[model samples]
Target: MSFGLFQREQRSLFGEILDWMLTPLLLLWPLSLALTWFVAQGIASKPFDRALEFNLQALTQFVVGQNGQVSFNLNAQARDLLRADDSDLVYYQVLDSRSQLISGEPDFPPPRDFETPEPGRVLLRDDLVRGDEVRVAYTWLARPDPERLVLMQVAETKGKRSTLAAEIIKGVMVPQFVILPLAVLLVWLALVRGIRPLNELEQRIRARKPDDLSPIEESAIPQEVAPLVSSINDLLARLTASLTTQRRFLADAAHQLKTPLAGLRMQAELAQRETDPVEIRGSLQQIARSSARATHTVNQLLALARAETTGRTLPSARIDLARLVRGVVQESVPRALEHGIDLGFEGPDHMPDDCLMDGNPILLQEMVRNLVDNAINYSGRGGVVTARVLLDPFSGVQILQVEDNGPGIPENEREFVLQPFYRALGTNVDGSGLGLAIVQEIAQQHGATVLMEDAHTDRSQRGLRAAVRFMPKTPRQE
Candidate 1:
């Protein structure tokens, strides 16, 4: 029952501690009792053995021998002293060297072992005689002739020693029966007090509102728990920033969509009122353009959201930079041709087969498309927009670049353009302004750097160049 009582209930820290402390104490208690009992027996038997020695010596003095024969005759007064123990029966024996009982009890047993006890010394041992446990003390008396020496022995039943040993045991162990339970009670109380703080902490957490995200107080927390509190605080700060960004994005999207939708409604009304065929056609054309712009803005907003999401959780795969850039450039070529802008890839038609790196393919493709789209949109007509995937010889880095003969962003305004919905002033391009912002966020997630510089230094035709340099990794090379 004791071995598994704790296992039947849910595990408890307190119970485990008690088991560790108390099990050894309980198992050793009986062993300690047995050892104490043996020691008590030795203590109680000391006085009795001494008394037996005295009787054996007294009986030795009564030894008499005449004519080469020996006998023991105790007078009444000395014999009464020998039988003085009230609680136990006593017996005596005297024997000649030839093993014949010369006097005292005729049936008394002699000492089983004796090597002629030295002079006046008394020897004591325990033995059973006549079906009763008894202690025996014996001494040998010397005669004029060494061959006729006599032996004297005295024996007593063990009742007095047994009683004294029981008293010693009771005296030693009774106090422990009272103190052991008190000690266990004190330990349990201390454990309960020691663990009270954790219960209070759990209660405090449960009492909080479900929507509460405030940081836990570090000052009140124990040093062991402070790191957990700090981590929770960090998570809350990030979530607050994410929520703010989401709200602002929603507002911007609503504002951007409002303008185009109103224009579409106005253009539709204009077409309904106009009777002239040319004017009606022009209004319908305006309506079509407004719808196209709205669609393009929606797609750009979706791309920006996906870019933000991917920035938080980046997924990787082996991406061939040259192949991905070529595909994105081809997709943007029709738009480039519509504006009469010369759009072409500047590097090898097929880059080195080893031009590969780890990246999220979809996000990387979106980044390239945004860069090329920005170039084609602002470069106007008769300008070249080139997309390149080149490897740097010195650094062994793979670089993706988009160069255009467009009005380059001024040095002072370069940082602002990477922010959401930020457009440089004095430019007439119609854009949702999230293109480069999306590119910057995705680039950050891939551990790449974005650099902006002039494609040409000529004052009349200084063009903007945007480049992304990937951190180098050794690729499989044949």
Candidate 2:
């Protein structure tokens, strides 16, 4: 099967260069030939025409009127002068004003009336004479005797004229034929020299390790190629970041899985040796809780992976922010009730008029769930976890704020907490620590901004507050 242009095997850089260089050169050859032929014909015909006019003038001088009668005369030297070359036979004729031949061949026809013939006009015409093709020149002559007007005609065979024209054409075209190929060769060489850097770049990429996501060096790259290299470097930087995140996730999963498996083993041993039924039941219960936490951690890790890979084949679309927030709160309410934490959605019943954003709904929901779940897990029983979506009129920003009355993070440690697998100190809660990182990634994908701050009420006590601000779709009216 034949491949399309894009899928075809790549041509050598040199070959591609040669094709472009030679194409125009080849195309111009025919044009050059045509132009050369035109110029050659003009050059050959001009002198011939001048020679015929000179012969006509010489014959005019020989005309004399004696006793009121016209006659023609020619000298031996003039005849010899006219027969200068032996390349082709020459013929001449003179006719009187009565359209009758006065001298030379009787079969020669009189000159036709030219549309705009001027005095002393000399023009070339083609004719068949004695079964041979000839080039002819004609001119009108005037004598002092009013009734003695004469027309002088000169003719030569085509062989001599054609030979002269061929010689001129060859001289002009032969040099160009040689020079054009040389120019094409030079152009091919220059193109090869120009494309060397691209080949070097390809070689550099091929030599790298599969896991090497380092940026390509831009110092030696040509200015024309710098943008392409910069784009590749940007992609490499993102891939490096992704690989680093994956490594951290793997390490965190191993650490998190080890603790639960060990606890389960210990619980099983205790249950096997227990004497009282209540003690055995308590050990089994502890094992079940540890198992549940382990399962939950596994599920979160899977969810994070899905969130990362989602939207690869799908495009973001307009999502209703208020509805998405409510849905997330509703799903997490059962968990919130288990801890007796108050989970409520505080936003417009319907999305505020004209409040919409381009986003992937599933990922957005995951982002909201992670933020609210973190608040619920951190806050104590009877603590208020308020999920608020507000559209600010002045700034034209849509804000989703989840504020919990739990001990807030220290200011210095807030930024560090966003790193994958980073857990706050002294928190006994079970989590993979990927919640905030996932929140940050999802927010970034939607072009939103995430900020963490201390929600202080009494100017002394600090509470946790995480806000994701979505930039407004349109400017607010005055």
Candidate 3:
């Protein structure tokens, strides 16, 4: 039962709109023709019907009463005049109350429901005369006696009415054949003009330079297409931000690598020049230190790059934050002992289901490792570093914190410390300043926030406390 009027895998907007507009007009044209033909027939038959009624009235005058009997006396001139018609043959009948034909054709059929005839009233009907359909107009005439009457009827063949109706149909329908196509063409032109804006938009996009990320102007766009334009503009804005971030990351990485690479090159040249065995060994030691620092810087750069990439492209799963923090702390114990720093973990022995959060395990572990390593390096010998994970029962927010007995970052430089290659003043730590930046990037990916504050409120022991606050898990995540 489906018309499937607009079936297409990839439909054209112009074609869809045109089909909707023209389908109804094309369908209704035939119905319009039918109605016009019906109306034309009625219009053509009116004049002929009036003529038959006039002739019927004229024939009634010939009726007369004589000696309590009805008769019709018509002269030859009047009868000849009545019969004079170029397109149709006319027939007439005169009958008495007893159903006796007194004059004219005796074969005329009686009117339907004519048993109680109203005297002196003319009525018109269609009936068959000699097997040919004709129009009949009939009337009753009163006699001198109140109970007696005469019936007069005049009928004519339908030849004249049929010819006029055909003429009217041709006059009305012949012009429409020429006009329909022209109307469709006008509609097509209108639709083309209406959708010209979208075509212009496509051209504008194609003509733009590859580096051009500017937004399209919204003022000139139609209200109907405003949403589409707005969405494209939003995409362009995000692409610009991503490109800017990549460019900055590359420039910062190049600048940071240059320092350690230059150091390694200089130390290598000095070791090659040394002739004394003691001097050679000392230069070799310095070269080893430079090489180690270069290796560490390269590794930090790679870690930062991985954290950013994983944030954007990696999928996440449910993980227990408490267990993850404990593992990272345990693994860092050897490194802590090498620096003579005491590192410990604190959290629930068995993590509850509510403490689980959704994240990339590899990235989250890298984030914790950077935080613990940074704490141990800055805390130095005999320093205490504690890593802990705790869950807020009421709010369901998960918290991961690394507290160290290192000089806290000044309040003014706390925000800057999270940016890559930024280090606090007067700190002698030999490390790339990328740990906090990696921590921040990973935290943001998991919908968490990072806070840098003092572990101890007292001014005498102002140790640093780096805390990450994870947003409450939704029911779906649980």
Indicate which candidate wins on lDDT: 3
Residue-level lDDT tens digits of model 2 in 1-478: 2222222266554565566567666877899899889888888877776776676667666766567555667688658645747687778787766666766777775556653434467777888678777777877666545545667777777676688899998898789879887887788678878888989999999999997888999998889999999999998888888888778778888898889889999999999999999999999999999899889778778877876777444577888888889988999999999999998989886665556677888888889999999999889888889999998767668899999988778878899787777888878877878899889878877778889998875758757889998986567676
Q: Poorest 10 consecutive residues of model 2 by lDDT? A: 1-10
- What's the residue-level lDDT of 378 in candidate 3? 90
lDDT of 1 by residue, 256-357 (tens): 989989999999999999999999999999999899989988999999998887556766888888888999999988999899999999776655545667
Give Cα-based local distance difference scores for all models.
Answer: 0.83, 0.80, 0.86
Model 1 segments more than 4 A misplaced: 1-213, 269-281, 311-314, 348-355, 473-478
Looking at model 1, residue 86 earns an lDDT score of: 79
TM-score of each: 0.69, 0.84, 0.78
Q: Who is ahead in lDDT, 1 or 2?
A: 1
All-Cα superposition RMSD per candidate: 6.2, 4.0, 4.7
Model 2 pairs whose backbones collide: none
